[model samples]
Target: MSLRHAVLAALLSGEYSGYQLTKAFDVGVANFWYARPQQLYLELSKLESDGLISGREVVQQTRPNKRLFMVTDAGLAELARFAASVSKPSFIRDDLLVKVQAVDHVDVAPVIAQLDQRAAAAAAKVEILDKILRRFRGDLDEETYLRHGSPIGPYLTCLRGRLFEQEHHDWSVRAAALLRDRATRNGDPPPVSGQSR
Candidate 1:
């Protein structure tokens, strides 16, 4: 999916200045999509020009004027069409995955370190998501909110992000452990197909 769609989805929450949108992307949308502030600013201009979104200048007492953006009817229609369309599967292009795959041929220390680092990052993301879920759910418990909350889309998306981060954390820890275990063996070949060669 394009950053355009992500921005549009964010505006579904309500109107936001470009600065606020950048912050929102950093905290929430970064889980599934990442875009720099510059990219967001540029996209906002494009969206406004395309008539997908409209911006209004806000006067401030001390600060310079900033434009707050809201989705236009065209934007909402576009988002609806996007939601109805079949999207291609998402794939990762991470360099760390490639390194992990080639661990047998390369040094293990760096790979282990990278895995540990990734695991920590994933854990951190899970914590962030948990906090966001709580804030979003407010007085309701997870089960109740999930079962009866209004506008459940964002919560559901956040749940998916949390689970994905958890999976990454679990996999990284396990991969690191297995690599360490293999390193301890004194030249014993790795077991293959239920037997050691």
Candidate 2:
């Protein structure tokens, strides 16, 4: 999906400045889509131009003037229409998976380190998502919420992101395990052997 659509979806929450939208995207929408602040800024300008969103300047004395955006009726109609359209599922575009596919011919240490990093990052993200889940649960029960939630997409996406991060952590743990096991199965690194590199 386009960042325009993502921005539009964000605007569905309420009016938000570009800065606020960036935070919303990072915290909520990053689960499904990734975009830089510049990209979001560009898209916001485009959406304004397209009449999908309306923006007003917010005066600030000490800081840069902010523009708060509210989704227009046309935007809402477009979103509803987009929702009615069938969407293809996202497929993986992971370099790590590609690396894993070719691990046999490569050194294991750096890759294991990289996976370790990914796992750590995922763990941190999962903690943040857990907090979101708590806030999500603060409202109605699951049945009622899912049926009539104000905006369930972010909550649902966080669930998916939580799972996705967990999978990364689990896979990294297993990959690291396999790498260490394989190393142990080898000639034992010559036991350090009092040898210099």
Candidate 3:
């Protein structure tokens, strides 16, 4: 999805200044849709020009005036249309994945280091998502919140992110182990037809 849609969805929570929206993206939307603060600001300008969102200038005594943005009715309609439309299948285009695929022909040290780094990054994301989920749930218990709290879109997405990061971390660890083993056995005898490779 485009940054425009992401920005529109973010505005659904309420009005936010450019800086606040950037922080929102960093904390919440980073799990799924990644956008830099510059991209958000540029999209905000486009969204305003398209009449999908409106911006109001908020005067401040201590700082420069900031523009707070909110989604317009047109924006809501656009978002609804986007939701109804089928999305194209997403394909992985990760450099790490490419490296892993060609590990047999490359230095194992850097690949192993990348895997560890990725696992750590995934763990960090899991922590961030967990914190966001806790804040979203507030005083409500999990059962009560799931049954009768606010709409669970954000909660559900956060949960998905948490689980995905966990899987990524676990898988990375396993991949690193397998690669290490293969590296150690690089000159070992080839397996017989009936034996495991």
Better of 1 and 2 by lDDT: 1
Give the poorly placed runs of model 3, Cα more than 4 Å off.
185-197
Residues 1-197 of candidate 3 have per-residue lDDT tens digits of 88899899888989999999999998887768899899999999999999999999999999999999999999999999999999999767789999999988878768877787888888788788878878878998878888887768778777887888888888887887777677668864322221010
The candidate with the higher lDDT, 2 or 3, is 3
- The global C-alpha lDDT for each of the candidates, from Candidate 1 onward, is 0.88, 0.81, 0.84
- Model 3 C-alpha RMSD vs. true structure (Å) is 6.1
Candidate 2's residue-wise lDDT over 1-197, tens digit each?
A: 67888889988888999989999989888988899999999999999999999999999999989899999998998888988989998799999887878778887666666677777788888888878877886767767767887568777878898899888777877776677677668843411111111
Candidate 1 — which residues are off by over 4 angstroms? 187-197
lDDT of 1: 0.88
What residue pairs clash in candidate 3, if any at all?
none
Full ranking by lDDT: 1, 3, 2
Q: Which should have the higher TM-score, number 1 or number 3?
A: 1
Best candidate according to TM-score: 1
What is residue 1's positional error in candidate 2, in angstroms?
A: 1.6
